[model samples]
Target: MTPDQATPLLDRVNLPSDLKGFSDTELRQIADELRHETISTVAETGGHLGAGLGVVELTVALHAVFNTPRDRLIWDVSHQCYPHKILTGRRPRAKTLRKGGGLSGFTKRSESPYDPFGAAHSSTSISAALGFAVARDLGASPEHGLGDVIAVIGDGAISAGMAYEGLNNAGHLKKRMIVILNDNEMSIAPPTGAMSSYLSRLYAGAPFQEFKAAAKGAVSLLPEPFQEGARRAKELVKSVTVGGTLFEELGFSYIGPIDGHDMEQLLNVLRTVKARADGPVLIHAITRKGKGYAPAEQAKDKGHATAKFDPATGEQKKAPSNAPSYTRVFADYLIREAEADPLITAVTAAMPSGTGLNLFAERFPDRTFDVGIAEQHGVTFCAGMAAGGLKPFCALYSTFLQRGYDQVVHDVAIQRLPVRFAIDRAGLVGADGPTHAGSFDIAFLANLPDFVVMAAADEAELAHMVATAASIDDRPSAFRFPRGEGVGVEMPERGTPLEIGKGRIVREGSRVAILSFGARLSECLRAAENLAARGITPTIADARFAKPLDQNLIRDLATNHEALITIEEGAVGGFGSHVAQFLSDEGLLDTGLKFRSMVFPDTFIDHDSPASMYAAAAMNAPDIEAKVLKVLDIASLAAERRA
Candidate 1:
């Protein structure tokens, strides 16, 4: 049967309030419908599918039992919020998920009153929820006056250092709050580290009555009959395991290993928790990623993220790209470098596939280290490896690398360790929006002393930069590349290391010179072509290194050309800022050279197609052509504007 027919009970419910009057049997039907609806919607729109499906029953139970909007429920990472969105008055707009001007794939505070806090990154919900709980007690007035705050964090997210910090603080404060650990036994990749093993042991035994009591958290708080089971479970945990559980030691009422997908159990548990619970409580609800849909359940990653696909067959409708992605290019090149050098090791903060380190892992398993969701630990660990006379490539997304800034400074730069950082997804990534954008890495990393930073213009440039980063052994170094397909440049058999601080001129012209950093090199050429149509031939140079400045090349362009423009796919304080600083210091601006620096605007750009996003940033080819024309004083009486 089709999803629409299966969702008869769901058809009547436009909001969470609609589920209030329904019986337990009817509520179960609504949950089933919600699952099918979530699957169908994701198949059409193409986004985070499995996460939402996994939480369908849990979402229904929460919204049905507890008062949301007033209660303030926060989903960690929020990729699982699709079902929550559907039941919370966003069902009509659900089909537009992740498209331009559509509902966000993750939760956003600005989007709805239901979403009290905004989140896209992992493991932030517990802290935010605790803040709301405190604010509620202090009589803080919000859109919806803060009631009971609930943070539903995934098992993978809970492994992060921030989550433990939140748990520690929440337990110490003893503020009434709820933290639901959605243990699906999988993050984007399979679960890792000690936390995963600990969670597994929580339900491994036949002591359900005792386990239930220990898991229920705060035995004293539960109604009279439930206390016997709770006390025994607490004791059972204390007897064989670490004293009174790690969570109990933190002063929280620990409950569960409960079946998250079971509708009756979810309803009973949520209702009881809402009624009872005096201090901070943790509900451990064991779930399966991609719970209902057979295709998603069977596939790897449980169909974590997908393109628009057929709901019937679960076949994604994606067009084949002509060029390899920068991620793949980085992986292939890193593998080649590792083959030659045994000291080359890799580390990732729980993102092996996302950062292309999985390929490196397959070739050299012992050398690879997936350090769970702890970026700070990963950075320092890599620093230690470097200090021990090993070449460690710490591969992490540019946005995620911000978490390890302190380690980057103290452990790597301060000590002058040769730790190579492979920063992926640099620049304005489409769809995932500003929260995941890699706009600040260039600005943040380039300013540090004893650091070498490079931005790749294309796939070929990426390979060269990787080789260059590998060759740099005395200091910390990083290279960044954007998401999605490369510019179809020819693949080198193997990369040759580039000069330390040099840049090459791409096209030689006398009137004006266009200097670009990163993938904006293509846009610079396009701008140059447009200028040529108006009898203006411009010189183009690639600013390979953001740090070293390539002072000779900058001086040559400034000395020879009447006008100079620097462009980069980064924020204000990045490549352009450095170039402008050098020019100002050297009195290059006083030479009456028409100088302009193009960077992303001071405001955050929203989610859209990559081409559209660049247009919003005013860093596209047309924007570049316009900048040159305005600087050259040719825009005033435009001599037939050329494309």
Candidate 2:
């Protein structure tokens, strides 16, 4: 079953338990085939291709040498788990990766027994592996084997503070675990900081080659009595020779910067380390991202994620859309704002293209800042810029913005710095699923004191929100918008800052009032039209600010209309919760006023189209119409009983 053997061993393997029977040579052949399969699958699916390809040999070597389901192999971020998934009974599902109702892009515990822990967020693998290790020690008896725990993390993930915290704890506890540092000198963007430089030196030195040569030479001359002593001497000699001083200081026995793509090298090193290592160990493997695909290898971003592409030429097909995306709209607006206002600055946490800040960066290079995957730093950096009298727009995805919540509360909100947070992907992101969905930002940002939160109903409103954020120089403010294209409404040539708490009436009607929040306004309007045909005319209002609640308009709507329905594209404790609280506080509920909040449900929503997800959550047109009917029934019953 060696990687070179043409037996299709990979196709036969349905589980990690299946690999237990294969010889080391056979395992090597499977690794090669696995790499081929991973490359082909990613070409079709268009996902985190490079990271997975780089770890194919390492993944195969790990499963072959270790009992996976029992041993617990945790991958950081799980972007590199395609090969791991292929080897662990999920090869057939690989083609459907990231699609609706298909295989997950990242590792998931529920998806397979071999995936003991799930991960989509970065810098969590080491801590998760350590937890498993500690649990195994406490749960297992002396007779039962408490299997090995391994965490394969990237060099980029190490830059996060959580990884260091895990490493520090593991070192102090002297846990029996292995931490594989897969150094490819990239993480979406190029690696940064002093740590990245140190790793570069280690890779350049090729310390593994020198250490192996010295150990073989010494072992050849050792007598029988001194053989045990000689082996210990060899480990000491190797440890010192490899410049593992940093890891050794942290209480980990560090091993090689071995070639990660080399199947034999990876297997041999992994086997040697697995058998001989005591306490915590760090095995550094150097790999090239997009190893097999030359086009991806040469691309600036390594073809990190693409649309459906040609496997032969690696050329991505253009997706047809009726209107420009909200991201592009924001990017164009920001550039225009920067052109007029010299104080305007842009910042992103390693996602220039995703947040649409790349255009701003190109147009105004000095004004743009990419702080790597360090969201906390990016927030504070923006705060600092604000303090210096610069209007800094911190462009970040809503889910990733969660990482900087504390900073938002402490640095920006508390001090009342005017840092404009342009929250992109602020609702149910299509394919990225729960970990990437921007469902909680509304609630989180609204709760923070001195923070003004706004949600855009359309691209035109988004332009206005941007202008509003820029004009407000006295306090911290944020505006959130969805992932895809805006509704085909004509945008204003220049934006005018709207009053903070004021909302506008889109359509005036009599029986029921629908107070819409954010991009969900369009759906509310559609529902209103549907209700109109049924002789139930509804009032539609776009409540721009989620925080302020438009108290005047809401109270008027509650008093005048038969029923009030609030709608937003966020989770339970967001806009809906705030409206519920407001109604309760205002004593409107005591008067037996009918009310219902339409929002994303309590459970985590999966990867699907925006329309499908809204329908699933009962936030679509039909669902809204049904809710209106129910409310009207309640009102009718109350009126009849009163009469």
Identify the leading candidate in terms of TM-score. 1
Steric clash pairs (candidate 1): 210-233, 213-230, 215-254, 215-255, 215-256, 216-255, 217-253, 217-254, 218-253
Superpose all Cα atoms of candidate 2 onto the true structure and report the RMSD in Å to 1 decimal: 4.8
Candidate 2: pairs in clash: 1-26, 2-25, 2-26, 2-29, 3-28, 3-29, 4-29
Best by lDDT: 1
Runs with alpha carbons beyond 4 Å of true place in candidate 2: 1-7, 20-25, 140-144, 204-245, 590-592, 634-643
**lDDT of every predicted structure (CA atoms):** 0.88, 0.82
**Residue-level error in angstroms, candidate 2, position 167:** 1.0
Candidate 1 structure quality by residue, lDDT tens digits, 1-643: 2645557788888888888989999999998888889989998889899999999999999999888788889999999999999999999999988878999999999899889899998999999999988888888876566578999999999999999999999999999999999999998988799998988776776556345545445677666887787677666656466212788888787776678988988887788888888889888898899998988999878989898898888999999999999999999999999999999999999889998988999999999999999999999999999999999999999999999999999999999999999999999898888888899999998899869999999999999998999999999999999999999889898888999879999999877899988999999898889778878888999989998789999999999998989988888898888888999999999999878888888988888878888989988888888887877888652434434
Candidate 2 residue 297 C-alpha distance from true site, Å: 1.5
Residue 238 lDDT, candidate 1, scale 0-100: 61
lDDT: worst 10-residue window of model 1: 634-643
